[model samples]
Target chain A: MTYVKPLPELTHEDRPFWEAAREHRFILPRCRDCGHIWFPPYSSCQKCLSFDREWIEASGRGTVWGYTIMCQPYVPGYADEMPYNVVLVELEEGPLLYSNLVGVPDEEIRPDIPVEAFFDDVTDDFTLIRFRPRNRTGE
Target chain B: MSKAEFSGRTAIVGIATSDFKALYGTDPERTREDLATHAIRDALDDAGLKKEQVDGLITGGTVHYEPLAYRAGLTDVRFCVDYPSAGRMCPMALMHAAQAVENGLANYVVLFNSLCFRSNQVKFGMGGGWMGTGLLYDSVYGMASPGAQYSLAFTRYQHLYGGTEEQLGAIPVAFRKHAQLNPVAIMQNSMTIEDYLAARYIAQPLRLFDYCLVNDGAVAYVVTSAERARDLKQKPVMIGGTAGRANFREWYVDLDFWADACASMKRDLMDPLGVGTDDIDSVQVYDNFSVSVLWGLEGFGFAPKGQGLEWIQDGRIELGGELPINTSGGMLSEAYLQGWNQHAESVRQLRGQAGPRQIPDCQRILYWGLSALPSASLLYVD
Candidate 1:
């Protein structure tokens, strides 16, 4: 079954980040001048205001900085996925990303827990970056 | 300019709110403009100023100021502006209007905020996908609602600061107690800490009580120069000092940065007001979410870092405690007119007109609000 959730509308600046997710590869925009890596890809470095930037591949491993279990469905598309965990992961490369934590129960999730990225192909055109416990054995 | 130059330059002479009870249910018969008109007329009457005396207008959350002025029977508006920003910018709007009156661009200015969320069936979290820029990252993950966004931040605060659900539960419990004393509050029943804990979690770590009520209503305040306000009907609630700051870079996505944003407000606002936290008789911190109030308490220098929940647990923030907070129920129990209602409550406290909820000898009060981008603070004195 295909996931019927609201998908990201790719933009000119953010296309590369979403395109990499489709191929199960995580990429972030890094400032070529200041060496500042940031999320939600932008044209310039937010720190140094430099337009010189490059797409750097991430290790796909991070610690859970914070998370919340959205028990209520604020959006209609998420009605079926009610009571889902939205996790903020601070990547080893030093950029935070928002994604879902899979392969773990709600009770098991905690801050600073190690997690690795895995792509869930929700539809042919869209793939979502999800996370799972790093210390757990093969699924 | 020196601090004394800005202190008591302008005053909020009159304030009013629409029928909060009529706002709870669907009011298809009334439009947002009607509420604005009602509040404006009532405020002018309270000030004992004729409608024609209003020479300036500042409106929030909507862009019906021209029609609102017409409906309120104001024919002479020298200066008019509209701020479509969040409720947190209410203080900023007041500050701008005060500046206008002080500069002689207008003799009298009115700031009005109104919303029909219940009647319009507006959902705050839905609609705006990512809301542009840095917020898109969180939106893609289904972290859209302000409640969920603030929950993530509050959860991180608890992790770093050693807070507990039971400790945070004290906030809504205190707010409900204040609400019971306010006849106009939407939630009149007192709530206990146990009731707060038992409530279901909309966003983990933030229970139902942590969120604010979404009833429809409007609030308006009339502003004029301090010299002119002295001649008005009610004693003027002088605007001592006002300041605003924004986290222009990461914006709302970073929870840890909010403390710094608020700290900037302290330096810019509190210093100019010439009053320390100890001097304030009461406080009206924005309670869009309960944790924001906790953040305000610490960020505004009432409590040290990692000690906000402790301050609440000690019962220092409740009515009759060391410092009373949100004596009119605030956004938590009162109708959410953004932060407009807070301004009205602050003025009431300063004028000693709060009736049963009045703080003893309330002469000075602080108001703080934090929207996603802009955070503002105002010091009001009698």
Candidate 2:
């Protein structure tokens, strides 16, 4: 795994999301008043418009929603990883996370495919959570 | 206000566009000049008015100032405004201009758009001082390409809807198929669902075909009172309703869905226009990306959340489907000149002037535009 520097500055609103990456935990915000979980950790819940929220750890289990196979290599750094599968994985908690699907061929990314998260240690500082197809084995 | 409240009042009296082509060779300022001039001439000819009659001008020039005054031949227009609002917000400017006219503040208003910067930089590497605000905080993430940002929504939609990748691929296939019939479309070749599914991915969840073609082109429109429309060459399609919307930010936030985009459009624009999605026979949806179209469809209540893929795959949005969308091939097949062509195409359909790709007896058109922002309009002819 290779480390990639985020091109933009990290703001206070999303600082927790990036900070959690160092500890290898996928963290998000949960409304303190309504008990609703928010992804990417916002200051308030879009539902009740309440600013009271807490950081909640997710189960990290979700299903592959939809994905696309990128042919053109626009970004110079990831050109070697051309035609990679980028997917949106829907967490059971209701927030959708944008991630890359690893350990699966580009053809396998479809709707409702069971998936789970695994950490990709790109570098000591930057660790990305990539999803992989869940195998139902020994049942 | 009611949707049809502006009936027999505001009308698009003029329309013009540049030669739709790749943006590699020409400078953005030159292309803007060509398109703005063409539109000005067309509007003057249709309205039977001279340059001196034009009193208002609005341009999407927030990033750069070259095209606003110097490039566009507007020497002494009374009211001139410029902003870096998203390309889709151009109609909001027109809506404002219409109200200005209704208030008797201006006689004639011009709205201009030029989309030639990206492809120019791609063909030849970007030179000094070409950065804009969108590239600042929004596209700061290296993975935040247009395709990548929209993929967040597409992924969530498919997760909630039970749609397969092949189903999502079907959208581009259908768009390209319709493009084959539109002579103005930049991409005229036939594409299939298999071809779409098989294409390589640009960002995760967004395939090569799922994105829009970036090219150099410009579009302009003139708005005048309905009282003055009958004196023009073509039948004036009345502007029934128009509204602009914005969220906290357009970047990839946690909740991929744009709730404001969904609610305000229904309450402020479409419902007031006296036409629901069913009442409108056709649409000129801004298809900047296949995913953006899906978002618009869901937000505009064309389909339920996550059901856009199924609606598209089941042929509900095809050319002859119950509701035909992007009849002008959309930005997906046509040039993505900031989605202004869709506005021009909607006017053509409303005037009964769309030659081959025209829908039969179409009296209403819903034009939806999306840049880094969202805005919509409903047009009708009686």
Candidate 3:
């Protein structure tokens, strides 16, 4: 089926990060001066405010920082996918990203569980990072 | 921390709010302007003043200030401005108005926030897709609404601090109890912990009751210099210290749950005001989501950091408890006038106009908007 959910409107600031994601490379902006890597990609380093920064690939491993089950499809295109989990993953590299938790039943999801990211190519133009349990029966 | 020069220099002299019971598709449905003009006239009447006396006009939430001033006959105003939408902007608006009143820029400032959900379909945290919230990220995963964002914050709060669903349910239940006393509160139905738990989730970790009411309503308050406010018909609620407002756009709430920031504001800004939480009689934390109140309690020092869930277990925040919170039902049961209603409730509380919900001998009230930026609070006293 075609991906009907909303897609991130590509912008000039974060194009490199998304383009890298398109290549199945989970990357984030890292400041050369401050050694800080942040998400939702900013043009400069969030910590040092220095425009001197570079995009670096992340480890794609993280724990479920927090999550909530969408009991209702408040917006369009998610009615069929009702009861899905909207999750925040705190990356091993120390940035938070919003994604869905797959390969784990909704009933079993809990906080601080080990998970690794996998690129789900929703459409030809975009690839979303989703997470699944490193061990299926892991807590 | 609020500017020292403007601290306690201005006062909220009169306040009024439109009825949310008359929502859209009901008889006498109101548009944005109708509600704005009505609230302006009523607030002026409440202050025992006339339209001609309004020298400053400040408005917010999609209500353009120029047209609103024209409708209210605030023709020659020294200060005429409008803030962008969102309940968080309410306290910031009050701050600017107080500065104007203190610096002699305006003798009287009439500030208001009016939102009509009936006429405009202001979607909740659902904006970032093409409109509000996120610029390029988040929406792709359907994480755009304020409720969705707050769900993450609340979930993180519990995971790091240790809390339970039953503990989370206590907030909405308490707000509903207070709403029962508010004559014009929208959600008059009684709520209990069981009811809160049984309620479905709009977003996980936070139940349906945790979200605020989105209704059509207008809240207006007349502001004046403290010297002028003393002569008004109503007992003025003097603006005291302010825990200066800050905007944190970080993807996740910091580990301290904003406690460190609140502490900095207290030490640098509010400490000089001489009236901390110890002197407060009532509290109105901006309850955009019931969790925001929990954040306020802990961040504002009412409860030990990371122990808000347990602190509110008793009736500490109820109408007659050690410290009353959201006595006018707040946004949960009260009409969601953005964050304006809480400020109005403080004014009402100090003036002994809250009726059955009134806190007796209430001389000092602390109201803050956790929903705005991380937080901003204005301490008001009679």
How do the candidates rank by DockQ, highest first? 3, 1, 2
Q: What is the DockQ of each candidate?
A: 0.54, 0.24, 0.55
Clashing pairs in 3: B1-B244, B125-B144, B125-B145, B125-B146, B126-B145
lDDT of candidate 1 at residue B95, scale 0 to 100: 84
Candidates sorted on TM-score, descending: 1, 3, 2
Provide the global lDDT of candidate 2 against the true structure. 0.68
For model 3, the superposed segments whose C-alpha errors exceed 4 Å read A135-139, B1-5, B24-29, B127-135, B251-254
* C-alpha TM-scores of all predictions: 0.95, 0.77, 0.93
lDDT of 3 by residue, B311-371 (tens): 9988888988888988988888887887788888888888888888889988887766654
Model 1's CAPRI class is medium
DockQ of predicted model 1: 0.54
For candidate 1, the per-residue lDDT at B277 reads 86
Give one digit per residue, the lDDT tens place, for model 2 in B1-382: 3446665489887777665643435564555455556666776675566776778877766324345555555566777777564656756777877887887878788777766555355432111111232122221122444556567556656556567778777677777777777666788777878777777766666777877776667777888899887787668888887776666443433254665575687678776555687888887777767776766777788877767777776677777888887876777777776667888888888887778777788888887765446677877787
Q: In what order do the candidates fall by lDDT, top score first?
A: 1, 3, 2
Query: Across residues B159-266, which tens digit of lDDT does each residue of candidate 1 receive?
Result: 788879899988888888888888788898768888899999988878999999888888989999999988999998888877777765433545563678778877
Instruction: Name the lDDT value of residue B259 in candidate 2.
Output: 55
Model 1 misplaced regions, further than 4 Å? A135-139, B131-135, B249-253
Cα TM-score of candidate 2: 0.77
